[model samples]
Structures are given as C-alpha cells and as structure tokens.
Target: MMFSATFTSLCLAAVAVALPAEKRAAPTVTDILNYALTLEHLENAFYAEGINNFTQQSFIDAGLPGFAAGRFSEIAQHEATHVQFLTGALGEDATQACDYNFPVTDAKSFAQVSYLLENVGTSAYSGAAQYLSGGTLTAAAAILAVEARHSAWVNSAVLKANPWNGAFDTPLDLNQIYTLATSIITSCPSSNPALPVKAFPALTFGTDMTAGQATTVSFNGSDASSANGMYVGFISGMNTTIVPVQNGQVTIPDGLMGVVYAVATSSDSMTSDNVTLAGPAFLSFDFKSDALLL
Candidate 1:
C-alpha cells in the first residue's frame, strides 16, 4: 500500500533533523539505534496504512475477533512510540522513514502480515542485544519483551496460529533482517545516512515445501548444478540445523513449528554472516497433528 506524498513528507519532518557541523563518528550503539529507527519507521507506516484501510467492522467481517482491530491500533501506537524513542535517542543521526509496498488487501491479510512483522521485530531485537551494553541494553530488553507479546497475541488471537514457537526465540543478524525488510520497502531518502549492512541476494522455493519432505530451492545468483559443497541452514527457534544440499534440494527436518528461516551457506556453522550464501527465505510450519499444515 502507498501513502500520500503529503503524509510521507510530514512523517519525515517529524523525525529527521540536522546533525552538527562536524560529523561525529557513530559508535556501534549509534549504528544500532539508527538501524532500529529504520525498522520502526517501516512498521509505523505499515500499521497506519493497514488500520486506515481496514476498519474494526472489516476485521470482524474477515473472521477475526471483535477486539482485533482495536488491538492493532494499540500495536500501531507502540510502533510509533518506538520510532519516537529511537529518533530521540539518536538525535540528529536517526534514519528517516522509507516508502513501502505492503501487500495487504484485506483484514485477514493484514493480521497475517502483522504476525510475521512482529516476530521478525522481536528477533531483530534479540539478535542485536548482544552488541549493546548498560542502559542501552536495558532499554532494548524492555522493548523486546513488548515485541514478543505483540507477536504472540497476533499469532494466537488474530491469525489463529501457534503463539509460541519453542523454549527460545530465534535471533537474526542485521544482514538477514535487512534482506527481509527490503522486500517490502521500495526506497528511502538519498539524504538518509547509510546503514553498515548489506542485503543478500533473493532466495526462492522451487517446489511445494513440507516439514519432513525434500524440497527444491534456488538462489538468485548461484548455480544449483555447481552447488557441490554448499549447505542449507535451517534456523528455527534457538537451533540451527545444517544439511548438505544435493542437486539443489534439501530435506526439511520434522517437528519444526512456527516460522523458520532457511539460508544457503558455504559452511555448516551459522556463527558468521560471511558464510551466508543467499537466503533467509521465509518458511512457516505448524505440525500440530501427525500431518504438516501445507
């Protein structure tokens, strides 16, 4: 969905301000703040567009609970508050909002997108926490708790899916999350400071995917015929399972619940981003019964 130019300009004005004459070197913490602010901006705009297009009655008509719309409004407010907090924390160095294209045609679609976004947001915070310290870490922890709650509520109450994934939640690094985020984001202002990260090439599924079945996958810039020693890394919850790729296919392990991120990697270990070849492809599995929810 697209917002009006006037609305976009106003939103940008509210958050973006001028830095000092002498450009101060940004520390790791500052970069993290800006990265967070960029995500907050996207989320803030997403909710605004969704809530504006779909009403409370519309949600009920779409088979969601009566209170789902109001809860979404509250979530939107939380995202806005996050934008404000991050912008304030970064002062003049905060990143500006970007133009986006969320594919939400109706209330049900909106709820599904919200569930995914909240889970990704929670994971982003969890992954970045290791790099923070003192009051900054404490502040991020507070926000992380709220993001997790948002994910659970929307997953269970709105989408009617499994709320919790496992004993621990998954953590994704800057490049991984940025790759996912850029799928919806169209563009950002040229004046916005560059983030210290890069997005991987797109990864796609070639055939039907199931929890315990072998599936064909493709990378945008790599040849499957030459993928002799590569591996497919399935990151679910706190576990990272790496299986060797054979003829461009990998067998997904059983008992994997909720959202899982699959990446083509050069090595079995997921400890470094350099090993990531292409992916972090979005996959969802709900193996509640003996069968997978295809």
Candidate 2:
C-alpha cells in the first residue's frame, strides 16, 4: 500500500512511505529547524564536556601540533554559539539542553568521539539543509560550513592526511541520522525537539579487506545468534543488510570504498529502533575511515 515515495534519503537514499498521500503533510521549515536545533544542542554539550576535560597540552600529548590544538577550543566556542543562536531563534519554544553520555572519558576518547560527532553533525546538517529557506538557510549554511571544517580538521588528525577528504560528502537522512546519533545521548529532558530514541548496537571491526584481493568486511559486536543483526552504513549513501556474517565475515559494497561510515543496530532499526530498547552501541571509529578501499 506504500506509494508516493519521496527522496529525503541520505548515505542511503530513496526512503519509502506507506501512508496515503493525503495523510502526509509536508514538513514545515520550523519542524526542520527544530530538528536541527536538537542536533546542535548535542554538539554543543559534547564540546563543552571536552573543553572542560581537556587542555591544550592534552592535544599536544595526543600528537597534534600545539598551533592546531587551539582549534578544539575554537570549535567548542562555535558550537556553543550555534546553541545560543538556535535557542534565540526559537525563543520560548526552543528545545532545552539535555544531559548527554558521550563515550569519552579521556583525551584519547575525546578525539575519537569528536571525530564521530562532527561527522554526524555534518551529515545531519547536510540532510536537513535542503529544507531551509531565507533566514533559516542563512544561519544553518554558516554552521554547516564550519561543521565540515571541524570534521576535516579532526579527520586529518585521525588520518594524518589532507584536511579535505573528498570533493563531495554523503549525508545521513532523518531516520538514518537519528538512529546513529541517539544512541549516545543518555537523556533528553525537553523532548520537544524530538530525537531518534534507539539503542543501536556498538559494532566493532576486524580488518575485513586487503585491497584488491579482499573487498569484504566483518563484524563482531552483537550476539552471534542474532542473524541479520548487523548492518553496514556507509557515507557513500548505502545501507547494506547482512543476514549471518559467517564467522563474522561478509562482503561490503564497493560504493562505500574509502568513505566514512558506521556500524548500526541493523536496517530494521529504522522502524523498530527505539531509544528505550536495550541493544549494542553503534560503532563509528575515530581512525582512518574504517575498512577503507585499501
């Protein structure tokens, strides 16, 4: 009965809608802004925690040059500004900041979590970017650019390569974005700006490829018996479903070659994924794009 499927999809495009056309009211710009505001709050809180916990020396000790270290503080300031700006735009209707439970408890983990969050922000903004207009577009566009820069800087630190990774980037749609992100957010008191509440599995990797000879990947994060429990999400915009990774091994799409990615709770999470459900954490590595096209 699903008809009139629109394309708001990202990293994996073309989502299907089963609702009758008459029941689907188009999302207003405010709705989109509210969603974005929630994500900004998440970024702001993440950086605040990092800034509170780390010092410039922390960056130096982590092998980053002292000159580039200030970027972290700068980024924190920017995220805070974004939070303020969005809240101001929403006035009394703005979403309240909720306490977060990031995976980082140290500088090393800070770097890792920051790398993932920024990319999440990037895709979040990118996917929602098309919905804005006029003033909303102006404010968000600026933040989007900076978010990209933040990701590039961290990407370079993580990979020790050029700050820019590619000419174009893939985005995560609403469902995909929230499914991957809501896992780390421990609590959201306001709930006005709704967020995807799902317990995504924490996926881990074991070198799944060897370039030309090996184009496959493997996962070992959930119960071995949860057949079809693992799903590979790629920045190249593809969500691949793997039933039972034989001994934790399966082939990946070449389209995801040399791109950013995450291992989520499974494609099924898109609909059934609820934040309250207990499941493995989502895995988005901080190192070079995990399982890249060697």
How many angstroms is residue 30 displaced in model 2 relative to the true structure, after the best TM-score fit?
2.3
Among residues 3 or more apart in sequence or in different chains, the pairs in candidate 1 whose N, CA or C atoms overlap within 3 Å are: none
**Residue 35, candidate 2: alpha-carbon lDDT:** 70
RMSD vs true structure, all candidates: 7.3, 9.5
Model 1 per-residue lDDT at 293: 52
TM-score for each candidate, following the candidate numbering = 0.86, 0.69
Residue runs of model 2 more than 4 Å from their true location after superposition: 1-26, 157-159, 190-233, 237-248, 253-258, 262-294
What is candidate 2's lDDT per residue for 1-294, written digit by digit as tens?
A: 000011001112112211111112355676666677777888888888788878878767877655545778888899889888888888876767656667665565576567667767877788777777887888888888998888788757643543543566656556556545555555666346443322233343333332222222322324333445544433343343322233444444333332344443345344233321222222222223452432
The segments of candidate 1 whose C-alpha lies over 4 angstroms from its true place after superposition are 1-27, 221-226, 287-294
Model 1 Cα lDDT, one tens digit per residue, 54-88: 88899989998979989999999999999999999
lDDT of 1 at 41: 93
Model 2 Cα shift for residue 60 (angstroms) = 2.2
Q: What is the lDDT of residue 273 in candidate 2?
A: 33
